[model samples]
Target: MVENMHERPGAPSAGDGLVRLYGPRFQSDPAAIYREIRREHGPVAPVLLEGDVPAWLVLGYREVHHVTSNPQIFGRDSRRWNAWKDIPADWALRPYAEYQPCSVFTEGEEHRRRGGALSDALAAVDQFELRNQVERIADQLIDTFAESGRADLMAQYALRLPVLAIARLFGLSEADAPSLAADIAASADEGEEAVRAHQRVVARMRRLVEEKQARPGADYPSRLLAHPAGLPPEEIPSDLFLTMGAAQLTTADWMGNTLRLMLTDDRFALNLSGGRRSVGQALNEVLWEETPTQNFVGRWVIQDTRLGGRHIRKGEVVVLGLAAANADSQVRPASYAHASGNQAYMSFSHGLHGCPQPAREIAEAIVQTAIEVLVDRLPDIVLAVPAHELEWRPSVWMRGLIALPAEFSPMYADRPAG
Candidate 1:
């Protein structure tokens, strides 16, 4: 219904366009930049990534739905991208732009085939059992730092719990969790390093797939192996590879961001103090505000088309501004109540390409469980460093804390290990 179809009158030049994703300015405060972009270029704005690779960054709420839902026109399968045809083999984004055998990189019936496997695999998980496992991990994590009185929650808790849980779900041994976690974390980094890390992760997953094939176990990976999707032997590990990377990063970042909000924002504390809000409500707020994945990868243009009033040519890349779209004032409620009952945010995206693991639900469960366990055990927990001084990692597609240092009353962690 909102109809200002063409690019806004004062759109910036391509050379001096929106904020660069890999720069410090974006790392500092991207919301302010997103606002400036919306004012000048409407919902879809011209932006540059690490290599000055031009793309349209979609920032409007309705606009996001328009592109994501219409995968036929806005294809996610990068193998079809026309622009990459000319780029050198060593292009910085090649690692991502290149074709992978994962469902995330496919389109149409192929996507359905692969995604169905992923969805079925995820659906088979027992939510109650998953929560129980998460809680056990949370308790074990707290036990490590409970007596110290001070801990970096980012490292000691937020980042590790989800990874550990996911590793277990994949039926990996306790010893493999740390190494797999490291590979997953590194794969999310920028530049050639990310490419190298991705290769390492793929190799590790291939080994895992072979292991599961020879001696299957009662885990998600094994489920994928037995599924009716009839996924090729080569595709199985690639699917698992993508699933592991996506789950670990998003869940970890979500937990970290939510914990950061509770520790840094006095309003959240006051809400808890007055019992006006629950930790779950705080999570919805974070999803709407500081989205876990700040931005995401390319949705290649299949043909020239008009979107959000801009002229998008075939083969050009379009990135979804998940956090920015969530902040779109025209679509988002003016107050918290309007957003409360209807948990509609671009955090999980909307259509076929949306996250299949129920990341939002899993994150909420993990974060709420972790916070409740921490607060119940250490009622006096407080921030070790001032909130304003905290640092965020610079990422092309993610926004996360480097560390979340907190101080709490020391106590013995006598909880039995699972």
Candidate 2:
């Protein structure tokens, strides 16, 4: 057993025992539980997941580094993770095996190949096209809410913006994009049915590519249809796989977190609307402060390996503590060393398979673009509801409010400032 993680009352018990962090209270407010364990338990501690599978939740930054860096020892295959397996086959997860994209879950070169194609597309995303489309969507959303003077930002802007951006980028028709986004997100939560819905979307994208064999258009799908390397027709299916994956929840969560932070944290509001440098720092702080992913980074142990004093058996499943580890004292201070503030957050995982995008940099650009529009266009903005009352979606892997309301003067263009 590790030392007591926290000494105070209501703090969780110490050590790597089978205590449930997802237990009811922990679900309601996880921040407090994390602090309790950090104060008492060491960074890496054994956790009995679902009260059965022997697992380790690496809490401290150093331990998280250790877990993520050793992919060979810790597995990336989610199927091997027993947490999903414990669900009955008849339950939504029975077909869960087929639902996930091979890009992030698999290791080494293959993962690189799948990601490479998408990055090529990401690179190809026209700055002018993206700016033009994204701004229009922003305006569309603002227009919808302008009359009421109040609107749910999550339902209205955060969710819609990324879905629209990704839809256009992937070459999916505007008519087809919404269902695909909802289906994929559902698959993340409800399992196979949701997975099937998402799979159908992928299949549809593949069909679109095939029909365009001779008359490929100027869109993204059509470009991939005409890539110089000559992707195998079979490989085209992977494009949908990659696109479905390339820009889904990650962007949506960022939108939610950015807006939430903007509305709730006043310091963030001032700096977030500032030019690129200040905006970049603020985004980094949010990633450091509140990592949205609840799913720990997964890896399958290959050979026998002992980590953090625990022996990880061959073929055993291990997941790195993205949340716990980011909050760990060491990761923070070390990251803080270079920067002036506590901005060491890890939502995209690290080592061989972290997010390839320049997150801190691009995040500033994307949200800053949105903020500039908001500030110049609708200055006296305020949240529709009290900050504490926002609703958070459950199932530990994601941390975003389901809905956020905003209120602003509708006729800002017409009225003169006081």
Candidate 3:
């Protein structure tokens, strides 16, 4: 049996093998756990995921870059992976790592083709109009909870605004967007629910795509349909499925984490209230400290390679240690130094497979606008419980609060102009 690192001395470590990435232990204080793992195992730590899935988690600043930047050596296609041959097809990790027709799992000419279609679709978004949409969505969402005197920001505000914004961008009717957004959130989880969620999202996106193809509009789906990439019928929905799901989830989490930090920490609260810092600064700070997706998976080994001085066999999977890399001593001499600059952070996952939507400015606008609206509407907002008592989702990948219960003086909703 593998010895457990977290076990108290003299206690049995039997049956406890590689470090489990799931559970309350990792969820409660992942930063502390990440530091311990990096210290003992250096940059490349062998970790066991939920289903006893063994994979190397790359923790160093330079090491993560090395693996992510070299697509020739470490391919994105999980179908090439040989490690899962013996593992059950229904293993928890399969849904995330399984082959998909989208850019996340593709490489070479195929990736460029699909990725370009997505890039063009995103580039078409008018920055000015997008920011306005974000502000509008924020106001609409805030109207729902302003008079309640108390709210779970995670559910009522942080979550709703992004989906509404995405729906507007995709040209989806208000009625269809919320259900699609729910599917996106569910897709981020593990187990049978995630599988079902994936299916539902695909079906929903396919219907949207077919409708768009019949009567093309100036929105994202129509743009993708018109792109010279000439995406196949089967692949069209996959593209929408990947892009919409990614945009809604990441943007929501980014907003949620930033708001949580602002509400819980005096440093953030005082700065914002006193005008010492901008919402953009708060965003940069959160990206460095508590990036929405702490770990990115599915970079398969194309050949035997040395990553961070450790030998990795072919077909082995390497997960990007984004949150760890941002906090790595080598990247920043001191942890707190990350808050000083708005420079690039690994929160976007670098290299050819990096995220393209919600460009920096768009993300900044969405999050900044959302927070500003909340503060404007409820200036006295404060956490209903101790910051430490807030619960985090138990998933190994997602980094977000389950709910952010806050209290403030009741105010009537500001009715929108007809």
Candidate 4:
């Protein structure tokens, strides 16, 4: 292991080493960072983020899973901690609330009750009625682009469906969905732009909250706002908005990544069960091979305790790289295990404080529906340009193709005279 890693008392076996988050060379290549952490240091390596945000880089799957799952030791409380994160309190509130959910950060019965309530509500979507609604939406999406025979699958097909589907979950009207979704997607990130975007959405959400409180409409948000049925309200709008954003972003990300993988990864999609299962498997591959939320902002070790290798005093931050863990081969049975769903993944996270949705089956179903439609309805479709020329959006914490440029024959309000 590199001497750069420091030692700490009572550290886990994996934590004895020098880990750094800011190196000029590593700044350009995060994959290399993961490689070094796994090959040289233990899966748990001590590091800092963006130069000074102190943390440990747990790049291996087991270590990350353990860290994420243990809320008792590694706290999820943002207010009591994360003051060093330095975003505006209001700006940070939305994303924090979204991931942590209604008392998700807490340990013991509060978490179980809140998580259980959410689970019960979410389970309601699996009913026969919701299935019909989902099927109708899936068919409608394909039909919209079906005549054209050529559509930007991400922009036209994959992106819109999840936004609308989540909107349906909230019982929102289709007419008002576009703006609402747009407003929510912006609150998912952290930075200057994220703060600005959050403020704008906060206003919109505040209006909706007040309106729902007054009128008490049929939407879940309305009922949540009113608490009419003796259900506790979970109206921290920023988080709700980010939940929507997460619902849209990761789904859209998998959609595009799935297409790219199917198109490029040795034609893996063609080998699937009648391509009947491309959506589930491909989506899994996308998460394992290239997750959207690579590094998640997290912190612990306040009041000076040992974490990773180094012993530090008060006010330190820790960032966990979920993507790195997803790709870590050590905890995985093989490099491709997560892609095959053989290993439980950091993609959906684990434990009480994890993502509050029943994301697995629902997301798979959504992806599967799209794949089924594309394979059945648009077989001749192929990438127009050599994929190497296609561009990807590069960010510290996200992985996705920015735009997919390809031409398919005879589609989308742009075909020549018949």
Candidate 5:
């Protein structure tokens, strides 16, 4: 058992056998760690967050599904967590575990009101227009380094595109998009500046809400303002902030991971150009394997319950092992070949709290269009470094490449657009 540095007397401790979710090994190869935990602890394993904070990792597909589906028992409210007293204000993971006024923490009818408004707002998005906007942004991003013949696609393209596109959707002006994008990126990092960055995001969203209220437009924020659900003015910004943060990072990582799969795997690499069919396969494969959201600080146990043959006490934290559940032998495909076209992966999560369908469609449109446009523009692009040399960002919750350096024949910025 790892020493529980934060454990206090009478506070719950998952006795002696908790796997630390942080450290170099978990950062480098989390799948291996998950497998080891599953072998030793079965479907549900006791785990420690950063700072020796104890929690349970649901490692089985069925267990994850059960937990997510039964939110009544495994609530979304993080206030129910028993370890809050042990956590410091500056804890890197606090942004996720702390309670907020957003829809993500709301339960029952409240969630329906907030979440429904968001869904309806998102559903109003013009997919065709969104795709066009994404393509234009992708091309502009590619143009930045196209003439250099080498570029880190992860930073230069994948990371920037989603936020910029989302900014437009929020009705933010062109001048504000870059700053919003940068703030969203910084807020996702587990750094000292994250809290301030998050504050800036909220401020920006609040301003956008005010603008939409005064001058409605055919945009997401405007739609939310007009929704019949009548979400409170103060509550709108929090929800909008949550929506932007969630959509931007997840979609960015989705693009980055899919690109990594295509560049690294021989099956996809062999037929890169004009392989629209292969692109779809790569996207689906990444969701099942390298899903952007690896482990979500998830459902809090509402009461004592037995899950995966282990007794969980009331008010305990239950981390949703999304990547692990996707890799579960019982549900996952034996091989990548068999995994093609299978969309049953819990990458987007499950149950009422699952990512809204409209949001998912918007993310897909952005990811698919961005990838297809890149391939169409630079048909011969290949990794500038060896496939094994690529590094993933050191984050336990999100899975994405640190940088994807690629080289291709030079295309001048002023050259005719593909």
Candidate 6:
């Protein structure tokens, strides 16, 4: 466990009242914590990252929208962050907070050019073909555990399906998909393993780019290389790495969280056994209630500004409270039922830096299909353990289950091939 901030010498004084964004309380039930923070500190509250680094957490819906919309004042460049000097070389969040040459950190026309190339590449993907690919992957995954009567869905299904589809989209072979998926999961974690895992992902992407350049195909990497943006060869790997990491983890959590909601919530219990009527509703509700991405290490202030009744200094970091924003009373409907069909939540952020339309479509297709296929294959599936007994991954950045143990009637009968 990380030592309490109060016990560390020279830490922000107790009177400062800056909340640590990590630790047990935040991981266990972040929604409750967000409400408490908003009650005491208003919308924009002072907070500490790992090592007690200072930053602001934007809790109000309007404040989050404003910050994401006004890119000129709040930039994407992490190099400008005032807290970089205080960050350790081996910071667990370095992969997200550090400046890299990818499209994620670029600004102005440069960003438009690189982002346009990405949008175009993703746009070229045939949605019909992608959906078919996801369905086939989903069926094959179910075949492995369909007869076991018990399985960990997180490791066995939700975690593996999206990466396999993404790897295929990138033109990687069947043998490489498993290792790539493992590396992506490890890279999202803390400590030395994450760092090394991230390096491996990048190296693999670099090799993929080289191979595509020599022998072009209908894959994402090939489309990127052939795009008219004239992106440099060296930079394509970083962009591909970012795309894979973002899609794999976020989509996996979307599936895992949706399954948890369906199995555990009384609202969706009627549809748990091969009912598709509530699948769309459950998927949308998860985005508003239990989004895969809880918080983001976000925009750096370009200059001093006043937001959400708080004074933010230039170069200070402002974490986007995406989950908090969705729960903001000002915009959130009084009841979950009322919030249906209202897709304005900040799960995907907003404006230039938000998830692109094509990427969102691909993710929705993969997640929706994965869930539908699972329910269809194992109509009698039920949670092996009580919902409350299930543990969440202990990370501030991502919200997902550590495991989703489930049980169903064993089936030894032969199944039709997809």
lDDT (0 to 1) per candidate: 0.78, 0.60, 0.77, 0.58, 0.85, 0.86
Clashing pairs in 6: none
Ranking by lDDT: 6, 5, 1, 3, 2, 4
* Regions more than 4 Å wrong, model 1: 1-18, 85-92, 270-277, 357-359, 413-418
Poorly placed runs, candidate 4 (over 4 Å): 1-29, 37-41, 45-54, 82-107, 143-149, 189-191, 214-219, 222-235, 270-273, 302-308, 312-315, 335-343, 411-418
Residue 95 alpha-carbon offset, candidate 1, angstroms? 3.5
Q: Which sequence of candidate numbers ranks them by TM-score, best first?
A: 6, 5, 1, 3, 2, 4
lDDT of 1 by residue, 1-418 (tens): 2245444433323577456766788788888888988897787888877777667799999988899889988998886666665566655566666778788888899899889888888877777988898889888889888888999988888888888888888998778877777767766766667777788888888998999999998888899889898888788878888788878888888878877887777666623343234567667788887877878876988987777877777877888899898898876768765466656789888799898755545656666777777666676677899888998877767778889999977997458999
Tens digit per residue, CA lDDT, model 6, 1-418:
1112232222222347678877878888999999999998777888877657777888889889999989999999999887677778777778888888988999989999999999999998899999999999998888898888988999999999999999889999989988988888777765667778888999999999999999999999999999899989898998998899999989999999999998898777624453577788888899999999889989999997777766677888889999999999877767776566889899999999999999999999999988888888787788999888988876677888889999988867666999
TM-score of each: 0.92, 0.79, 0.91, 0.78, 0.93, 0.93
Per-residue C-alpha lDDT of model 4 across residues 56-144, encoded as one tens digit per residue: 56676666666676665566665545444553345433354324434445457765655565555455555455456656777777677
- Superposition error at 297 for model 4 (Å): 2.3
Off by over 4 Å in 6: 1-17, 270-274, 415-418
Q: What TM-score number comes out for model 4?
A: 0.78
Query: Compared with the true structure, what per-residue lDDT tens digits does model 5 show for residues 136-230?
Result: 99988888888889989888999889988998898887788778767776776665577788888999888888888889998888888788998
Determine the C-alpha RMSD for candidate 2 after optimal superposition of all C-alphas: 5.8
Q: Taking the tens digit of each residue's C-alpha lDDT, what string does model 3 give over 1-418?
A: 0123342222111244557677779989988888988877777778777766778788888888887788999999997777767667666556678888877788988988888888888888898898788778877777777788899988888777888888888888888877887777887766667777888888888988888988888899899888898987667787788777767777888988987887887666623364235566777788888888789886988997677657677888888888888888766535443555755678888878887754555666677777877777677788889988999876677788888898988987558999
Locate the minimum summed-lDDT window of 10 residues in model 4. 8-17
Candidate 5 colliding pairs, count: 0
Q: For model 1, state the Cα shift of residue 364 in Å.
A: 3.1
Of 1 and 6, the candidate ahead on TM-score is 6
